[model samples]
Target: MQALTRPYGALHCRVDGPSDAPAVIFANSLGTDLRLWDPVLPLLPHTLRYIRYDKQGHGLSTLGGGTDISDHADDAIALIESLADKPVFFVGLSIGGLIAQTVASRRPDLVRAVVLSNTAARLGTVESWQARIEAVVGHGLEHIADAVMERWFAPAFRAKPELALWRNMLTRTPAAGYIAACRALSKADQSAATAALRLPALAIAGDTDGASPAELVEATAALIPGATFHIVPGTGHLPCVENPTAYAAILSPFLKAHAHD
Candidate 1:
């Protein structure tokens, strides 16, 4: 485990693969930790050093205050710049995707390429996000856990016993962390910046994803020039968990192609 301490708090991260390998960092969705990419790491090209971390307020990381997507992006950039020996390939999902974009735009030299999964430049209406924040603050994470689960996993996947693990993870997430992230999302609208990025990029969508539908994910891809887009059939928002093979099939080639570019 590798850790980086910031003025506000510290981030807990894990790195695997050869030390001399190219770096590929993954940022997970809201309510999930670095483990979100566990299924996909083993399937990635062994030539890459895969890195995953628990962002602020999730997993083992501290829940800091007064941060937006850019600050989250900076934390990722700081982690990579301090640890990685070379430029990194970044992959992010949902809110993580927003952070990925901010990273690319603000620090293009540190990033070689990026893959945006199940996310968009702009999410739901601000009012809807505020309602969600209020619900979580007023009631508890349990209040919105089920509805979020519906957006996260397909019905078939939900029926399986494995869903309980994710549900537990969701409900266990710190309320302050979840609410702060929601407020950040409510204010995020990265259309122009995302559209302006010039890099190797791919956008992934789960066919059954309700939160970030295929069209929404594709739209983000369309923002970047030469970006490739794909859809993972049968999976929902968090496709990396449901079908790691499918997610890796698309990502491995991108990493290989852009490893040196």
Candidate 2:
């Protein structure tokens, strides 16, 4: 694991594929880390470089104690700047998707394109997130793990033994990190800024996504002038994990057409 300690706490990162090729950077959702993209990475063409990192407090990195989405965006931008000097295709899921939009808005030059999967311009109301904050701060991450899993994956995916692995990932996350991220999502409203972005954008959705369903994701796509949108059937919020093949089918062509050189 490589380490970057600027603009945020130590960020655990990895770069794969050809070093000279165009870069693709992936950020994980809340309660998860860089491993979220593991299944999808190998399926992609190995010609382009792939960058993955655990956001501060999510994996091997320390928490920045930040409570806004911009801080998370800065972490992403910092990593890209530290590693190489070029535009990147930013792909993210859930809160990671929010970070993609935030970064594209703040620093378009650093971004070659963006793929937002199972995310939204605004996630939840202040009261709902506040209640969630209270629940986690008082009870702990395990207290809400099941609910998150239900919303994250389809019912069949939940029945498998592998679901236990994700449950552990959620339960093991530090309460402070989870709560801080929740606070950031709660306050983030990227509708205007996201609409203003003219860069190449794609919004992907899972048909069964209870957190951010296909309809909601489509709405986000409509915000961008020429953004493309696609839906992965029978999956929920985290399509990249539940059905990486289908996710790759959509993502591969987009990268080839837009970012691949």
Candidate 3:
């Protein structure tokens, strides 16, 4: 429950593994906090340090007036500079993926590689995001929690009692924070920047993800000169949650391959 204070507010952060180890930073999806990586972290090698944090207004962190993807990228850059001795492996999911792309482009020296999970260069259109914004601002997160769950997890996961936990997590997020993130998403298009990235990159997608389909993820991966891509079977948007083993299997090797670079 450590916090890094910035001009806007404090960022809730947690670090694990040895301090001298190589660093791996995780940026989770919208509507989720650092806990999004809980399942996958333990499955990864403990030799590397793991850094996780709540984006402004997502978990325990304050909003700090962030309205675009660059603002979020600023938060990540701050964390990496303060916490790690060297460049790290940056792994982002959903909206976090957009942040990873931005960070890699803006501060390539801070990142050794990037793993984009269940995301694309551009996600949704302005009109669609505007509609979603209206829905949340007018009706609240609970109004769209069910539909979000449908997009977030496979049908089998939705049927289980544990679904309530994730649903509550989504609904409990601050509306102001969520809406700010939506606004950022509406304006972000990283196609050109992503294509220009010369660092190692890995893109992972879920087979049943309705938000960012496998084909779309593959296309984004193709934009990078030598990016690798993989899909976890029978999962939805959050494969690291529904199928951490498979996600770790795909991620661990990539991290190891680039650990010393």
Candidate 4:
């Protein structure tokens, strides 16, 4: 529950494990805060230091007029610089994935590798994002919370009683903040930049993901020279939440392999 001051505003951050351990930084999805990685954190290796933070306009962080994915990446860059003294393994989900790619592209010295989960280089079209923005602005987040839940998890998970928690989180998100992130997604295209990366990369996707399907994630992985792609069965966009065990299984080995790099 720490906050790091940035040019736009302060970013709420949380760190776990040994202070001097190899660092792993997580950037969460849109609409969700740093808590998005809570389920998966305990499952990761104890030897690593894990860092998670709320992006501008999400969680307790302020928006301060950030309008693009790069703006979000700037916060990530600042966080990494302020905390970790060495390069880190960056794992990002959905919109966070876009931010990871941008950070890796711009500041390779700060990143050792990247794990992209349930996301693509380019997400929705401008018109589609504009429509979503209009819906949230005109009707509020509750209007689209149901649909977002469907995209977030598999039907089996949704049938469980715990589904209510995520739905509530989505609907409670600040309208202005969520819309600002939507505008970022609408304009972000990291295909070329991601392809240029030479660092170790892993892209994981849920087989049943509605937002960024397995095919889309695999295609994005293909852009990178040697990025490994994995598909977690029975999960949707947020596998780390739906089945943190399986997600951690896929992620743990990557962390081990790149721990010394």
Candidate 5:
């Protein structure tokens, strides 16, 4: 684990692989930390450097209250800029995808390419996000973690041992942080920004993902010219954990093909 002070707050990050290798940064979804990427990292070839960091309020990172996606994107760019001069392959899931899109749009020079997984350009109805915020703040993370876990994984995967582990992690996250993220997602609208991105991009979705349905993923892919779209079989929102091998099979090629040399 490594720590860095960015403009927004202190960021806790995990660096893997060779320092000199082409950089690939993985951003975690709302309510989860960089640990979510643990299963996918080992499957990736060692030729590239990997950076996984907790978003503000998610893991070890801390920030002032009411941080939005744009703020989060700035934090991400700051972290990457502090680490490497080279552009990086930005891999993001769910809310992370929203941040990646924001970064690519505002600071295209920092992004070599993007891998957006199990995410949407615009997530949830306003009412839904509001309800989510209320639920988390009123009841706590554990109150909604079970439902979140169900949405995160397919029915079959819910019975797996790792599902329990993920649930525990989700349940223990700070309710304030989770609610803050819900508000961020509530207001985030990247449709115009994402459509303008000309960088090489890949959008991966799970066939069973209720949060980001295949159609929505397909629509998002269509917005970006030449964006490759792949649907992971028998998985839900968190395909990186639900089906790590298959997720890697799709992601490794995307990373290799567009890696900054």
Candidate 6:
């Protein structure tokens, strides 16, 4: 793992492949860290540089106050500019997708393309997010982690032992950080901004993802002109983990096609 200090806080990251190659950066979903990409990273072509990092307050990264989607974008931009010599293909999941959209919209030159998975323009009902924030604030993340995990995985996945491991990771997340992120998600509005994106974009969703259903993913894909959309079979929100092979089948070709030579 590598560490870089940004204006907001310290970020912990992992890099793979060669520095001279086109860069690909992975931003994880809410409550999870860079480890979420463990299953998919090795499958990426070695010709491209890969970067994965823990968001502020998750994994090895430190917690910072006043975090928002814009702040997250700043962190991503700072990291990319400092670490990669070339422009990058940005990949994000859930709230990470929103952050990627913000970065691409604000700093088009920094992004070569984007892959947004299991995310939405407007995440959810403000009321639902607010309730989640209150739950984490009042009772701690453990109180809601189970509910979150249930929503993240399909019924069959939740029955597996590996799913318990993922749940354990969620249980360890700091309540304050989780709640802060929930607040950010509650206030975020990317509908107009995402629709305006002019870059090559790919939107992927899990067929069973209650958080980001097929209709929402289609709507999001439609917003970006000529964006490609794919739905992973038998998966919910975390397709990268639940159906890594299928996720990579869709992802690898798109990335290979878009990656600069």
- lDDT (10s digit) by residue, model 1, range 1-261: 667897688788999988888898888888899989888888989988988898888888887762588768878988998879888988989999988888888888888899999999998888998999889989999988899999999999999998999999999998888888888888888899988999989999999998899999999899999999999999999999999999999888989988877
Per-residue C-alpha lDDT of model 2 across residues 23-106, encoded as one tens digit per residue:
999989889988898888889977889999988778888888658998888899988997766899999888898999999999
lDDT per residue for candidate 4 within 1-261, as digits (tens), equals 799998777889998889888899999898998889889888999999999998888888888665798899999999999889899999999999999999999999999999999999999799999999999989999999999998999999999998998888888778899999999999999999998999999999998898999999999999999899999999999999999999999999999999997
Report the C-alpha displacement of residue 42, candidate 4, in angstroms: 0.8
Q: To one decimal, what is the Cα RMSD in angstroms of model 4 from the true structure?
A: 0.7
Error of 3 at 60 (Å): 0.3
lDDT value for candidate 2? 0.89
Specify the poorest-scoring 10-residue window by lDDT in model 5: 62-71
Q: Per-residue lDDT for 1-261 in model 3, tens only?
A: 799998887999999999999999999888999999988999999899999999998989999766799999999999999999999999999999999999999999999999999999999999999999999989999999999999999999889898899999899989999999999999999999999999999999999998899999999999998999999998999999999999999999999999998
lDDT of 1 at 68: 81
Please give the distance, in angstroms, between residue 236's alpha carbon in candidate 4 and its true position after superposition.
0.5
For candidate 6, the TM-score is 0.97
TM-score, model 1 to reference? 0.98
Please, what is the TM-score per model? 0.98, 0.97, 0.99, 0.99, 0.97, 0.97
Worst 10 residues of 6 by lDDT: 62-71
Clashing pairs in 5: none
lDDT of 6 at 167: 88
- TM-score winner between candidates 1 and 6: 1
Error of 6 at 149 (Å): 1.5
As for lDDT, the candidate ahead, 3 or 5, is: 3
* Ten residues in sequence with the least summed lDDT for candidate 4: 58-67
**Candidate 2 clashing pairs?**
none
Among these predictions, the greatest lDDT belongs to: 3
Best of the two (4, 6) by lDDT: 4
Better of 2 and 4 by lDDT: 4
